[model samples]
Target: MRFIFAFLAMGLLTIASCEDDGGDSVISLNEGAVPNILKVTGSNTFIDLIALESGEETTINFTVDKGQGNIASMDVVLFYKTGTTVYRTVLESNLTTFPKAYSLTQFDIIEAFTELNSAADFQVGDVLSVSADITLTNGSKLNILNNDATPNFGQDIANSAVYKVFQNYIVSCPSDLGGTYDFVSINIGEPGGFVVPGPETGTVTFTDNGGGVYAISDGSFGGWEALYGPPGASGVTLIDICNTLSFGGSDDYGDTYTISNVTTSGSNLSFSWSNTYGEYGSTTLTRTDGTDWPDLTN
Candidate 1:
């Protein structure tokens, strides 16, 4: 019931079970003790999500114990939202043991989208919610949503009990943009130095500046807009919060260029970029594979 990481990821949450004494096997008004979400040692309370690369899997561990009652089972579920309504789907369910772990793979997420039933494809813009519930043998349910009297020792569920959102990343391609490359213009016939040939081997750096932000490597646009160039070329581009590769900046010549439509092939990167005061050209950068990258900051 709290917001932590904002995306699907390769990490898991571990749950530990409580001892069952088999005393009072009924839900009472005075039932006080609740299960707790174990925090990682010396880390913040936030849970890291899984980005789910190809052939990736992560196991989530949790436990459910009825202190004075007989243990029933625990259900860890996943939910996705559509418009204003939310749909509930079970990721894992019915665990009646201590220190239980449920592992999910990329195939699991794909199955969540289209499996025995035809759910919509999990795209880059979709959000899913994951939560767990413990049903006691006495027919009572307990989860993060059910508020305790003092709101005592528990997980960081946000105000008013809302499930955390999991962002689905269908494509990142961020790493593909980093490498040594040779840039050439697709269409000549324009000025702004869209003709020069030297400097064919420039470096492009991709750094994850935390929170989906990154610093793109320096370059000159056909020797036009230089990020790090000769004589007072002091303009750097920051890939904004949306994690898009689109950005516009002015060169030392005071000329501006809008960069967009960035894509990559097998060691070849191409994008349709244009100078505002000059001409539009499709620039291609053929990257030299396995080039040593500068130390990056996450």
Candidate 2:
């Protein structure tokens, strides 16, 4: 991709050289000037707004190069999305340095939005995109992004593996479901005295494995442990992807399970699970942390 951009730049220089008639039709650019390419360096590309405190932030680092001395300064432009509308503001201006670094806190974004008269609060799933607005020494402006806020460069160059001029960060709400809860379960699929009777009450713990995945202490929530043989169910896990719950792993007998019919009321959550071995259980987990349970659904 770098080679392709270089080739295109060389072609542009050739056209510019031919147009320089040495009289009244001379371009202000140098004889061998090439287009600039914004190269990204080390950086964190996501803004976990949920985890950020009052002074926390995310950062972006990059450099402007390949301009062949024609580049003068650049401006950092920020674009944030809310609902169906995209609003933009000039983040920083007259940046004449190479390998520049900038950090943006949630307050910074909110302040920019306030400048645009936006009263909406930034939320999860919103995207914050950034780009460069370059100015040449000849007093000419060069911007690969069009007026419609879309990249005017070639698709290959925009998706280039060697260079990145634009960066987009998503506001993420990391899932953390690590806690202890009191649960009540009743066996339905395999009735009778083989399973725990009378809507058994017990304690279950959920261990967070990061990124929305969790290791559940009991897969059956005490429905299959006490009566369904010695080697009780284990290795059970659950995934809470964007408030949607799903089951993973199998029991001790290699019977995979499925979770469905998840419902929540205030801070309480309930769900039904069944394994392949004709064992089904309905359980309700009550939160003790006083915080409302996540609005999860299956």
Candidate 3:
């Protein structure tokens, strides 16, 4: 009877060790048997979506480290999706070392996308994803970002706070139109309809409101403040989307505005504005930074 009891205890232990719940919830002590991840660490991972001829370049600086070894060689592939089509280009291959420094330039990105037969050259708001086509030591192939039944790593590992492999870069035109400007405006509305101090000449400031938006020191190009008093027509801001300028948020008097006829010359920006309150002004804001204002459209 003692021998039978010992045999039953050993059988139960074996059954528990080999249990196959066949789900992600299954836990085992042999986690080390899982495939390792490729960790990337860096901060400069975005491409600025400026004109190709603008000489603007983004330098992606990051170090890739193989977690738990076993990787023989890998190919770093650049990928982007357009509509239902996914395009890919090999940026580097035959990487067999750990803690490799991956430095890429914006032109490199352009070349990769161009090589992949991109319908149109990369544009703002496009995303570029990087993945590794790894060759394991035991003669097996694995893609770091493959979404299949037998993925190289689980979500907890993929989205691991410490060990990360996936990387995504967004093509964006970062806009920064903040600082004081030489402002001038001519009021052209009805006489008593929000009168302005004729050809108002003063400096206005564009306070960055983040994400390509700015709050103007004087909403009506100093017209409201010159006539109505302090804090006149506040809460108005400029929304710049890919150099297309527009107005956002109503004024203190709940009056919305529209901008048109925007023109740029050197570092000067001029436009015409009209408010819902029947006030209109032709304004010019010259940049103090000596940098040309982006050619903006309504």
Candidate 4:
């Protein structure tokens, strides 16, 4: 996907250093205590499916404990599983404008998934996992919240809200195919200013079993890196791929990246990867048919 920001004027201000204020509190999972609410909602794809099928006719109700004070805003990262593999999408929401009495609040927000084909791509049995990171404009406190095994396509599921205190959380979705078959896209976005050795460019090869399994590799990486599963399996996890590559090394931080987006069409796939902390540079790879997957070591 292209990095075309609708507001380029805000570009310079977008890249801010992540603050490590000691005021940020980490919640212990055993505490059973609730955190402040800045933002809350389902996955981006969940919202997309709801909007497309229900026409914004759905309402999510939940309340925040506030812990100590009001939460001004929050951001959430949602994950979905295709067989055993997991992909993620991000959503941001602000709820400070709402009435702040320790009661449930309802609101609507957009869940954009321009990459997926349609709402039918998801189903009921599938899971919608959520992780929220909250921030308050006035205080130095941060809340990190996490939830798993959240059911889909119902009002009861909408009523559940996982609360926490801070500005960052990571959610994991277990194996939830939802009875939909989709492809994974691989696209390399624009390189950041701190990229070393500049941006690298190459081609990615994806081969569908004509079923669900797919094999993907980039010539830049020297060999085919099986993406979905083993050479013959139907799905592969993100951890599997990262572990296969052993991303982090003592001297070669410039060889690893964090994949941000992944989408696929028929036998075609497109995904994007960004350099993390001066790690591996960025590269764009095109797909080739019938050709053997490229080697990654060279």
Using TM-score, give the best candidate's number.
3
What local lDDT does model 1 show for residue 113?
46
lDDT digits (tens) for residues 153-243 of candidate 2: 5333433455556666655556767899998887644633355554777888889754455788888887765554333467778876568
- lDDT score at residue 49, model 2, on the 0-100 scale: 57
Q: Which pairs of residues have clashing backbones in candidate 2? A: none
Comparing 2 and 4 on lDDT, the stronger one: 2
Stretches of candidate 1 exceeding 4 Å from the true structure: 1-71, 82-85, 113-120, 143-298
Q: Which stretches in model 3 have alpha-carbon errors above 4 Å? A: 1-43, 51-53, 114-120, 147-153, 175-298
lDDT of 2 at 272: 93
TM-score, per-candidate, Cα-based = 0.32, 0.43, 0.43, 0.26
Q: Compared with the true structure, what per-residue lDDT tens digits does model 4 show for residues 6-95?
A: 245235433321333343233332222234443334422222233435644433333344443345554544455445544555554553
Q: Which lDDT values do the candidates have, in the order given? A: 0.41, 0.64, 0.64, 0.32
Candidates 3 and 4 compared: the better one by TM-score is 3
- Which is superior by TM-score, 2 or 4? 2
Candidate 2 Cα errors over 4 Å, as ranges: 1-43, 52-69, 115-120, 175-298
lDDT of 1 by residue, 1-298 (tens): 0012311211332222133345444323244423333322332111123333333343323323333334476665555544444556666678666544444444565576433232223333234444455676778666533221112222323211222212122122233233345666554223434443333334455454332333445434344333213432224343332235554334433345566676655656566665554545566666566443222221
